[model samples]
Structure formats: C-alpha cells, structure tokens
Target: MDKLKPFPAVPSDGKIETIPFLKACRSVVKLLETFGPVLMPAVDDIHGNVKKLEKIYMENQTEFKYLNGMLLEEKRKMGCHARIALLWLRRGLELFFVLFSKVVEQHAAGKVLQDLRPLIKQAYEETLEKFHGYRTKQMCMGLMEKFRKYKDFLQIMGANDERSESSVFTILPVYLDGIKCSTEAIYNRMVKKNQVEKHIDDAETEKTLTQRELDKIKVEELQMLQTEEKKASQDQCI
Candidate 1:
C-alpha cells in the first residue's frame, strides 16, 4: 500500500495473505474512483466488503493467516461469516476488474468515446448482471446512463504529462493482470474450470496471462497508438 499501489502478490502456496489481500482490495476501490462518481455504489460495496473481511481478520490474526484458509476453516466448522465475506469481496472484485480491463482496452485502441454506457453495460452483463436481483440490475443500468470523459479520468489516474500518461497505461494492464492472477488463484481453488470459463472466454482472456503475453499486450497497445498518432500527424503535415 505504497505509492506504487501494487496488487497483492499471492504467496507460493497460492493462498492469499490476509492483510495483503485486504490492502490489495482497498487499492482496487481506489482505482474505481478514476471512473468518476457514477460507480459510487460499486465503490461503496467493494470498500464495505474489504472492511468486513478486515474486521473478521482482526478478530484473530494467527487464526486467519490466509484468506483461503479462513474460508476453508469456516467450511469445516460449518460457520459462514468469513466464507460469506470473502465471497462477496471476490464477486465485487471480479465485476470491477472486468469492467476496468475493458475500459483500458478501449483506451489502448485510441478511442475513448464520449458516452460509455455501451461499455458499462457490456461489463455489467459479463460479470454481475445474472448475479444481481431485478432491482439491483435496474439500478446498475441506470448508473450506466452517465460516464466521465476519458481525458479527465486519465488525469485522475495521474496522467500529468505525455510521458507519464504512457507510464500510467502501462502500469494499469500490469495491475489488472496481477489482480486477475491473484483473484483467479483464489477462485480456481474453489470453483471448477467450467465455471470459470463461463466468466471469461479462455481463448480471449487467456485464463491467466504469462509475462510474455502481458508484454505483448503492452507492446501492441503502444504500437497501435503510436501508429495512429503518426498517421494523424502525417495527414496534418500534408
């Protein structure tokens, strides 16, 4: 939880460290702010879940060394607080991460539309639509009616200058991939492969990105933007 805003690194056991897991989630809640106030409801829910888990973890530090461990123990003891808390937290992270990834992808392609409801709707459908009850889903759609301009959003994400903007975007996907990995590691332990496939297309989303694939994405995005900028510059020159 420093200036780097690093995602929690899952330990070698692939079990999420309790304190770090909570910190990482708080980081995601912070990221949600860049989207503007339209997502305040989601931001609130995610932040609340983090607090829920943190409170329970604080109850017994040694007992809850790892998040997955806490859930497994709850299952064994036939209790549900930790289980339910983590479940909601995981679900919230998936919804937001999926949405953020799509936003970054659109921006990488050199397009950030003035109205982004379509993107918002798509993310909602993919992640949280089926899970929510009718009223919740309706509220979600209503929120989609508004969105922040991309330039202003990027400014909040710390795009102070040309060089810094590039740095911000580069760091974004890496953070996304890190969250993707940590969350998946926790989820894959509990959910079946088929269940995961239902969330993201294996071929499209890669299930998990290797460092090489991550680098490829960054390179491709930068090359695409650079090419577009150069072409526009040439046209203006002509």
Candidate 2:
C-alpha cells in the first residue's frame, strides 16, 4: 500500500504517456485486489482492458507513446478494439474513483465501513450503472451483500490509520482529475476525428436530433448508398 503511487498529473501538453498511465492503472488494480470477491469482476475488467492498450503500445512503442496518439493511429487503421477498451477502461476508472471518493467523504464525516456499503452501491449507480445490463447490475448488488467487516477492510486498503487515511484523502482528488482530464482529452479527439459512435434520434426514429446531427446523418446515409452502388456495379460484371 505504501508503495502504491497516485497517477501523475496530466502533462503540460495534456498528452498522457501510455506507459506511465498504464502503470498507474496497474496500481489501481493492485488496490482493488484488496476488495476480495466483491471487486474481482472489476479487477478482471481492468486487467483485460489494460492488456488491450498495452498490446498496442508493445507493438508500436513510438507511435503509441501517448494515449491520444494511440487512439488516432488505431482509429486511422480501423482498429476499433483499442478504442473500445479505452471506453470501458475509462468507465472502470470512473467507478473506482467515485467509490473511493464516496468512501473518503463518509470517512471524513466520521462514518465507518458499515455505513459505506450503501455508499458503494450509490457509487455504482453513479458510475457504471447505465452501462451494465440488468443481470450484471444484479450480480454487483448481490456481491455487495458479502462486503467485508470494517476493520478488516480498512486493514487491507491500508486506510486504518490517520497517516494512511491522509495519504488517500490527499491523493484522491488529483487522481480523479487525472483520469477525467486524460479520458476527456482522448474522447474529444475521437469525436473530432469522427470516431465516436452515437445514436441520433430524429422524428423518424421518434427522437430529436440537432441540426448538426441531421447533416451528419445525411452524409452517412449518402456514404452507405455509394458503398452499395459500388458493390452492385462489381456484382454485375461477375
């Protein structure tokens, strides 16, 4: 626990170094390992997604040096897996941050671990609830029922003492900021690159789409039509 380092602040250029960011995530996984069976799923998700990003970095260390660069390169190559991994990884980090921030809030208010179980549930609702299917959400709630005892839990996380608590309290805010900044930087880049996939609702779909969205939809529809026409022309010769 003492060796666990908080993620470094985003660099001056706002480019998160891939290796360093992944190293910080490794620390996140190490800490979550303290939660036993309750967080094993999250542990697995983080480990898996980290590997996805790490694989790309290993394949092209220089080109994939920064997170945004990796996203752009992968997206340019139509390699969507790394981008998807990033989406889930960001969500998992968000969940971890929310849960720990809530715990810190409760602790500051003189609350103990017994009082934190519901807070943990609330954190899930705030972070990962929307993304999780009904069954997975239920499984998460069920696992909450087996949460460990207060002192035992604290001991595992090294939060039992004033010094350790202070360490977390001091580090949590900056860590949260780092995650938000880095993820946001990459997400914005994806959107600018037209790599973000989102559904736009129109009166046709019984949903409302903005003017920009309406134009974007028309462009995509035209592109699809062109593709089909090209394919039909090729089939005629065969």
Candidate 3:
C-alpha cells in the first residue's frame, strides 16, 4: 500500500487552518485540553445571550450601596437601629475578653468560683433588644447566627471551673475575629450591590429615550408653521 501523506504542520502561535472534519475534531480536542477549565465557567454563565448570574450580582451590588449609605448616615445620626447594632458587637467583644480573663485567672490564681453574674446579666440585657432590632431590620442575620453559636459556647463553658493549660482560650479571639470579618463582608457586599443596581436602572432608562428624534420633530413642526405665517404676512403686505 502507498504511504499516507503527513498532514501540514501549522505554526504553534498562528491561527488554526481550516481542514477536513476529522482533523478539525482533533484540533478542537487539543484546544479543549489547553483551555477547557479556564473558559468553561465563563462560557457556561454566558450561555444563550444571557448572563443571569452576572445580572444578579450587579443588581445586588446596586441595592447594597444605597443600603450601606443609609446605614452609615443612620449611624451618624445615632439612630436606634445603628445604636443597637454597635452595642451588640461591643458587648460580644467585652464578653469574650472577660470570659478569657476568667479562664486565665482560674489557671493562674486557682480562682475558679468567681462570680460572673453581673457581667453576663448586663450583656444579656444590653444585647437582647439589639438582637430583636436586627431581626426586625432583616440585616445582620448571618452575624446573629454566628453570635448565637458563640453565646451557646459561653453558656456551656460558664459553669466549668477546671481549666487545663491547653484549654481553648485562643478560640475566643478566633470567634470574635470571624464575627468582625463577616460583618464587614456583609456591609461591603450590600453597598456594592445597591450601587450596581442603581446604575443599571439608570442606563436602561436612558437607553429608552431618543433626544435626537424628539428635537428633530419639534424643529420641523415649528419651521412648517413659520413658513405659513411668512406667506400670510406677504399676502397682507401686497
């Protein structure tokens, strides 16, 4: 049998050549191997001339911006909602530090039965209203959930007197750090979502208006009326 001809070798960085179906299939497979993972998610999101996830992300950002600005102003004005939020966060931090100190004391000075009645009572009272306020506002639900977890931990550890050197006092700081990070993330996301939505809405409105068409119509009508008036005036003069 005669030897089959070798396919032409295309340059590595050049445009792909049009070829027979089988060869094209091989080229597509090679391209997929090269870039599938990098391109798949983007293409999937952009399928059928729709970018649903992108639109959702943009709208959320727009709504978030407006909410964030309003919240900031409310905080500045010492609004009840803002006050409650600040108090809730501050109380959480204070509780963590106080509990941590108590753990340290139990380890070092052998003071295990020291009363934390007043501090815990105060934290509960101050934060109860704030928690309720957050629930009402529909803000900080995620923070509240994390706060509940910390509260449960504190309750479980509240009565324990024996403190091992390897106890998880460090975890208190980690919990507080997580709360701070989550709160900040929520705030930033809300602000960005609000801003993006507002911009999208404004763009859509502007797109629907045709200023050039309206102006041209008005000018043409005025010119036609002016021409009739000029002819009438000439007739009267004659």
Candidate 4:
C-alpha cells in the first residue's frame, strides 16, 4: 500500500492518502453512471404503475363507502341489540382509517418504525369504545380485539426490511380483509334473532366468569392491604 504515490500536496502518511480516496470516489461515480440508464426506466415504470393504482383506488372509494353503508343498514334492520355491536364497528373502522392515513402519510415521508409506534397505539386505544350493556360491551371487545392484532403486525412490520416505504401495498388489503371477516362473523352472531336465546345463555356464562375474576382480584387486593398493615405493626414493635 505504501508503494502507491498520492498526488502532490496529498498526505503520504498512513493516516491520510488521497490517491485511494479519489479512486474509490471515481469508482462510485462510474457505477452510478453505468446504472443510470437501467435505473431510470425502471423508476419511471414504477411511477406509472403507482399512478394507475391510485386512480383505481379513487374510482372505487365511492363504491366502498356505499357498500359499507349498506352493511350498517343491514345491522340497523336487525334491531337494537345488533345496533350496539354496529356502533362499535363503525367507530373502530373510523379510528382505523384515520390512524392508517397517518401511517401512510408518515411512510410517504420516509419515516421508520419509531415514528409509526404511536399512530398504531392511538388506533388501538381509539378502537376501545365505551358501551352500555354487557352484550354490547362484549361485542365491542370482540370487534376491537381484531383491530388490536394490528399492533402485533406493526412489530412484525418493523422486522421487515422495507419499513422506510409505504406498506400500503401489503398492509391495506390485509387490514381490510381482517376487518371484513370479523365484522361478518360478529354480525352473523349478533343479528340472527333465532340465536338470541343461545347468545343470552352464553352471555350469562360469560358474566358469571367475569364476576369470578373480579372477586379474585378483590381478594388479592384485600390480602395485600392486610399484609402491608401487618408489616407496619411489626416495624412499630421493632
């Protein structure tokens, strides 16, 4: 390496050498120059494809909304109890869209996982809407729990190498499909009047289990308070 002569005024010392540095820079420039012809065409093709997809999505937006409204109308036709689950589903979908838009915006600006965590968390939190009846609340839980899986998906997406770009290509379809499937299943269970008695029995069983869970928690809390009081007494004696 010492045998190579750097240009005049360039450092000959091992710590600094101009010749190899210039050669490396020239190599990088040449590589890009060679790649330019192939790369530009590919980039243009990708841009065109993206524009087409955007156009299609725009065209379908109205149709999507109409279909969604029809589903809600169907739920409404099913009566009051079904409407309980419907309300949560509507709110959850609204929150998901807003959060997803933010995620897409951040991704478009080339943000990474750190920037995305909060948007995902906000979506998850917002989906947990309040409901009155135990059946309604359970239905809400079932609906939101499906959305909560997206939080886990973000962790998996972080592991993927393509975090810097819009996962819209993958994420959107998966989200839509999951929400659709869950909505259908919940709707079928909640709206079918024939299953009302079965649902009530199931709800009663669930209520009993939930009450038992609350009792256990209270027992544990009471014991913890007693232990603290006993410790205080022992400290005073000491």
Candidate 5:
C-alpha cells in the first residue's frame, strides 16, 4: 500500500477566491448606491404632483361653491352649463391620475427595496470566508466602515436605522443568523468526523488483539503435535 501523505494546509483567513468574492460584493453594493438616490427623486416628484393636483381640486370646489345661484341657474338654462360639467370631469380625472401615480410610485419603491434585500444578503454571505477567524475588532471595524459609507443606500432601499419589520434594515439579522448557523454546522460535522475516526481506531485495536490470540493458539497446537511425534518415536525404539 502507498504511504499516506499529509494534506496541504489551508490559509488561516481563507482560500484565494475569498478576496475576489469580497471585491465583487463591494462592487455590487456600490452599484446599488447610485440607484437608490435616483429612485428617491422619482418618489418625491410623485408626491409633489399629488399636492399640486390636490390644490387644483380644492380651488375648483371653492369656485363652484361661491357661484351665485341666480347666475348658476341662468348658466344652466343655456349651453354654457357644459363648461361646469367639463370642469368637474377634468377634476375627477386629475384626482384619479394623481392617486394612481402615488400608488404606482409606492409599489415601485417597495419593489426596489425588496430586490435590494437579496443583494445585501448575498454580499454578506460572500464576506463570510474572509471574515472567518478574524478578531472581533477587525471584523466589526471593517464592516462598520462599510456600513457608514453605504448607509445612504440603506435609506434609499427603505431600510432606515429603525428596525421596522417591513424594512430591509431587518435583513441584517438574517445575515448574522446565516453566518452563525453555518459555523455551527461546520463545527458539528467536525465533531461527528472525530467520533467516526475514534470508532475506527477502536476497531483496529480490537482486530490486533484478536490476531495475537489466534497466533498464540496456533503455536501451542504445533508444539503439542511435535512433542507427541517425539514420544511415539521413542516408544517404537523401545
């Protein structure tokens, strides 16, 4: 059988791919930074439009309410009444469009936030290899720097510092949980592997003991047979 060789040592930090993945994750987050600011302005614009439409609606209502009944009746008796009907229809359409725009903007913003969560999660996971075996200070300081720098993206993603359940801010805990669970799984597997090795060692020891016993039994039988042959030869001589 070939002699067993020792396996190569793994780096304390991680494999060669760890650094590349970390860089990739950083790049992804950086790309997201530009997007959040862009979408925020769109949402603000929608709200502004809503306010303008609301002002127009209120002004139209007030104008109609203040109209003299006699003038209104005179206008109603003529074809000029169609102007009021048209104004009401126009206001209704504007209100509907304003409300619809708000809803659409909200849905778009929400979708962006939802999409950001998975990207954040993936980046967090990618950092795990590099983070492994790091001192608490090193890890915390490094990640904190990143958090501070990219904080705007968080706000843009609708994940502010507030720990709202619907906000992407809550996803931070999910990243932590993933790291913890994966570490525990690795540790558990190592324990099981050690247990398996110990059982194999015990079996090898038992086999050695059984083999030694069998060899001793065979030697004793051979000695008895040789002695019997010697005694029978002497008896034949006599």
Candidate 6:
C-alpha cells in the first residue's frame, strides 16, 4: 500500500478581513443628518398651518356668536326692515369664507404631513438597521475568534481525552450565550446613543427658525388678522 501523504498544515497566521459595513452605515447616517433639517421646515410649516386654521375656526365661532347677537339687536330696533338682509349678507359671507379657508388650509396641511410620515419612518428604520447590522458583524467576528482559540486549545490538549469533548460541549453554550449578551448590550448602547443624539439635534434645531422666516410668518399672520378685522368692522357698520 502507498504511504498516506500528510495533509498541508493550516497557516496559523491567516487573517480574515471584516466586512466594512460600518462605513456604509456612517454614510447613511450623514445623509440622514443632511436631509433631516431640510424636512423640518416642511414639518413646521404644516404644523403652523394646522394651528392657524384651528385658531381661525375658533375665532369664526366666536364672531358668529357676536354677529348673531348684533342681528338680534338690529331686528329688535329696526322692527322688520330690509337692513337685516344686508347685515346678514355681509356677516354671513365673512363667516362662510373664514370656515371655508380654514377647511382648505387644514386639508392641504394634512396632505403634506401625511406625505412626510413615510420618509421619516424610512430614515429612522434605515439608521436602526444599519446600527444593528454593525453590531451583529462585530459579534460574529468575536465569536469566530473564540471558536478559533477554543479549537486550538482542544488540538493542543490531544485527541484521546473524552473529558475534553465533554468540557467543550458544556463551555460552548456559555460562550455562545456570552456572545449573545454582548451583542444585546452593544445593540442597546447604539439605540441609546441614537436616541440621545436625536434629542440633542432636536433641541439644537428647535431654536433654528430664522429671523427672516419668523418675520415673514408674523407678517402674513398680521395681514390675515387685519383683513378679517376690517371685514368684520365693515359688516358691523352696514
């Protein structure tokens, strides 16, 4: 019989290169940061429009009561005259337009907010998944290292001892559990860091409304208020 050729020895110094998923993750994170601020104005604008509509609706309700009171007093004094017709026409149009405008504005705002919701959720999930993926890769690398070391130790301990196999079987589960625990801890830390970073970013951006933008919003609001007041006063006069 031919002599059995010895198998080539495995290189002990072989190095495995880890996947660079973290670099891709960092790029995604940077993208999220850049686009996140761009979306904020749209969000804030929608919110402001909603609040403005609500305020206008409430004001219209109050004005409706006042108009009704005025109409009642006019009817009592005038005693069934055509002046009531003009009064109702003017006041009624004002109230109708106010309600109509509020409805229209609110509808528009709701549509914009709805469109943004999906984008926000996607960005959040992408960041979360990337973080999880990085942690998993790290844990896998650590487990592989432990596996290599354990195998080497077992080889050095020799093949005849049944106790070594038994010990390995018992300890393997613990090693796996430790890796799992480590992954969980890393995942939790990443999540906490994301949350804290988000909080800080939100806080910093909260006061980022530019003076020009704020002034423009204020002017538009004042113009609307003035227009409404003028219309109401004109109705009361006639």
* Top model number, TM-score: 2
| Local accuracy of candidate 2 as per-residue lDDT tens digits, 103-149 | 66777788656645786678778866676667777888998777676
Residue runs of model 5 more than 4 Å from their true location after superposition? 1-150, 156-166, 191-238
State the TM-score for model 6: 0.18
* Ranking of models by TM-score: 2, 1, 4, 3, 5, 6
What would you estimate as the lDDT of candidate 4? Answer: 0.37
Clash totals, every prediction: 0, 1, 16, 0, 0, 0
Instruction: Write the residue-wise lDDT of candidate 4 on 104-197 in tens digits.
Output: 5655576554434455445544543321356644453444333323333454334244452245335554444443443344345332322322
C-alpha positional error of residue 59 in candidate 3 after TM-score superposition, expressed in Å? 11
Q: Which is superior by lDDT, 1 or 5?
A: 1
Task: Name the top lDDT candidate.
Answer: 2
Would you list the clashing residue pairs of candidate 2?
Answer: 201-207
How do these models rank on lDDT, best leading? 2, 1, 4, 3, 5, 6
Number of residue pairs clashing in candidate 3, backbone atoms closer than 3 angstroms, sequence gap of 3 or more or interchain: 16
Q: Candidate 4, which ten residues in sequence have the lowest lDDT sum? A: 1-10
lDDT per residue, candidate 5, 1-238, as tens digits?
0111111222343211222222322332333344433222222222333343333334445433322221233233321222222222222222222322332344446743323333333333333223223453244334433332234544544545556424443443333233233223322322231121222222123235455554553454445446766888999999
Predicted structure 1, TM vs. truth:
0.73
- Candidate 4 residue 170 Cα shift, in angstroms, is 6.6
Q: How much does candidate 2 score in TM-score?
A: 0.74
Off by over 4 Å in 2: 190-238
TM-scores for all predictions: 0.73, 0.74, 0.25, 0.28, 0.19, 0.18
2 versus 5: better TM-score goes to: 2
Q: How would you encode candidate 6's per-residue C-alpha lDDT over 115-158 as one tens digit per residue?
A: 33333334333332232345543442333232222233334324
